[model samples]
Target: MLDAMLPVILLLILLYVGYTLVYKTDEPKKERKIHEDTQEVKEKHVEKPKKHVAKRKNPVETTAPKKQIQAEHPLLVHVLKGHTSAITACAFSPNGRFIATASTDRTVRLTLRESLKSKNPTFKTINLPYDYATACSFSSDGKTLGVVTADGCKVSLYSKFKTKPECITTFPVEHNVLSLLLNDIGEEWMTTLTIGKDDNTEIKCWNTSGHLLQTVNVNQIQNYHGVQSLDNRFIAVAAYTPEVKIFEIQRAKDGSFSKLNKAMGLQGHTSGVTDIAFDGSDFKPVNHIVTSSKDGSIRVWDINVRYKLQEDPKCIKQFQAPSGYYSTVDITPDGKWIAMTQGSALYFLKVATMQICCEIQNAQDDDITRIQFDATGIEIFVQGTTSRIIKVYHLPIE
Candidate 1:
């Protein structure tokens, strides 16, 4: 009788528990208590309002890092390696503190510009991609960047940040923009005078707002490519061939561009033109134009005579590029010296005698492609074939 009673009691307890759970549910999910400050956003539950939550933002928000990898200019500074393709052009910032390089790698780089015999000032390197960037330049203010593309008919302006640059606008080009320039005032800009496949040599002038202001047509097709001057009074047209043709730029009352006169024409190089730069007009008496050619020669033109379209410049001087294939040529802003490249070797020539004043014996090497000076003309920067560091050279400012 006891054993039977024990079994009966266990069965009754199990049945009671099952009935309580299965048939006696207390409340629906709607009656469940919720947190007072909880909220939902994009499938995420927030226990506190956005104002109460700590906001996360970087004080120095970095932009998309350009695809190239390299440190800024180093103390031993081997700074830039260009794409495997030929690097086209390079420029220094207006303040003489930064360097910008353009290459066929479809990207450009901005780095601190430095110059020293054995110790280079440190600088940061950051790549900027413009897809097919053929060349890049900084305005006189160092605030805007102008990019020349290979296959495009426009010059792209990028607003430069401390770490990178942002594309501000694209100035539609009349021809393939072999080069782009900003005037001294930073108000006007000039594009390349290119010989189009259609047998036209046109230069499209524009303002910062992307408004087309004027178009000047020349007689034949040519590439006035390389360095351009921003003097509101003169336009330097570095010809596709080894010739330097200059024009007088007169801003008419209507704010249009018109050639006042063919101010100068220089012809001395046997090979194609490589690069050309002008010293400051404030240089002693007359300004000078320094040019480099593929034939490994650097020439200086005295822009003292205002020539007609077909005439020649009155005074000119020439120098031999270091014994190698010359790739680039540049001049300091104050018009004191010239810098040109032959492979990885860089040569600095004095403006007065055009003598080799200084040489970075190994700037780029046979693998090196381009070189340029800072706006203040104290340092030399280089671009190498697949080298992150082109090369940095600091010369004693004489």
Candidate 2:
């Protein structure tokens, strides 16, 4: 009986040992691994949710929309880069469909104003007779363009319809031509010449046939620029002095240009006047003359009251210019604002209040030689001094 009892007890002990090793120890190890894995998964889920929530609460949502909006509305709309030398002058067609540019490379280039950024932009370049093309202007009828060389002797007129602009005509002058002007009907033109040692310069008006119509003598006018009013009844000249000379353009009863009469002088600028601009088309004369001066001031004058001022020409509004010489000034087609350039910067001023609306700092790589507004005044073209590039800027909507 003792021996049987001993065998049974031994078997029972072995079974217990086997049960503990196979079931209890292995089960606990498996459950521990599952628990550890579940805890790791839970921790991962918690961290992931926190990261997502933090991202949603932080700049991720705000900055994304802002970046998208900024991408959609770029300040710089287009860049034109065909010129091989420094650009001297730029003028937009009256219809606002094209822009003509003159360069020291002895080239006049026409670019479609609307398609400047297209894959194959439409541009026509004509080689000029002389280098250092100084200035250019478009006739208000959009049918012809006039370009001048630095010597002020050769003036080339081009017809827009021709492919090569077969040398429309050349007008000879005695002095270097500094500025050129064309009438709205494309019938008449005017040019300003460089001053000589005798402190004398000539402002000549010519008909379409290149016949000189009227010649007015101006004394000591330096860096002179001229523009005709929208009605073509007045021509305003600004130079390296505070006084701007106003001339009345006389027209015949049959609507032909006759001659120029010295009207008066606008005196306000303390230093040399760098640029001048008219408000709108000559058909609807605004009688508003905007001017920029080296005195770092931009002044607007009402020509309607130009003759009333006894002493200094009174400005309707005045504002300080950006840093550097106020090299150029242009008014929008709508006559609501003025665009001025000093050095590489472009400044926009509200016409009514003379408040600075916007400023594009260092808008170009070099000096801004010219500035122009399109027909709608929604875009601006800026030409640089030596870069030979035209930068198009879109006016920001209020």
Best by lDDT: 2
| TM-scores for candidates 1 onward, in order | 0.62, 0.74
Q: What is the TM-score (0 to 1) of candidate 1? A: 0.62
lDDT of 1 at 294: 71
Query: Cα deviation of 365 in candidate 2 (Å)?
Result: 1.5
Q: Model 1, range 1-398, lDDT digits (tens) per residue?
A: 99979989999999999888865564333333233223324337534455666777775675665688554323234445534565666776766566676666666666554442225444333344545665677776677767767676667777654655677777666566655666544445432232232334555667666676567664434654534454445666555566566666665565555443556667667766656777663223336777777777777766655454444654467776435646667777677777776766666777778687666655554556556665555666776665544566765456
> Any residue pairs clashing in model 2, and if so which?
151-176, 152-176, 152-177, 230-282, 231-282
TM-score result, candidate 2: 0.74
Please report how far candidate 1 places residue 290 from its true position, in Å: 1.9
For candidate 1, what is the lDDT?
0.60
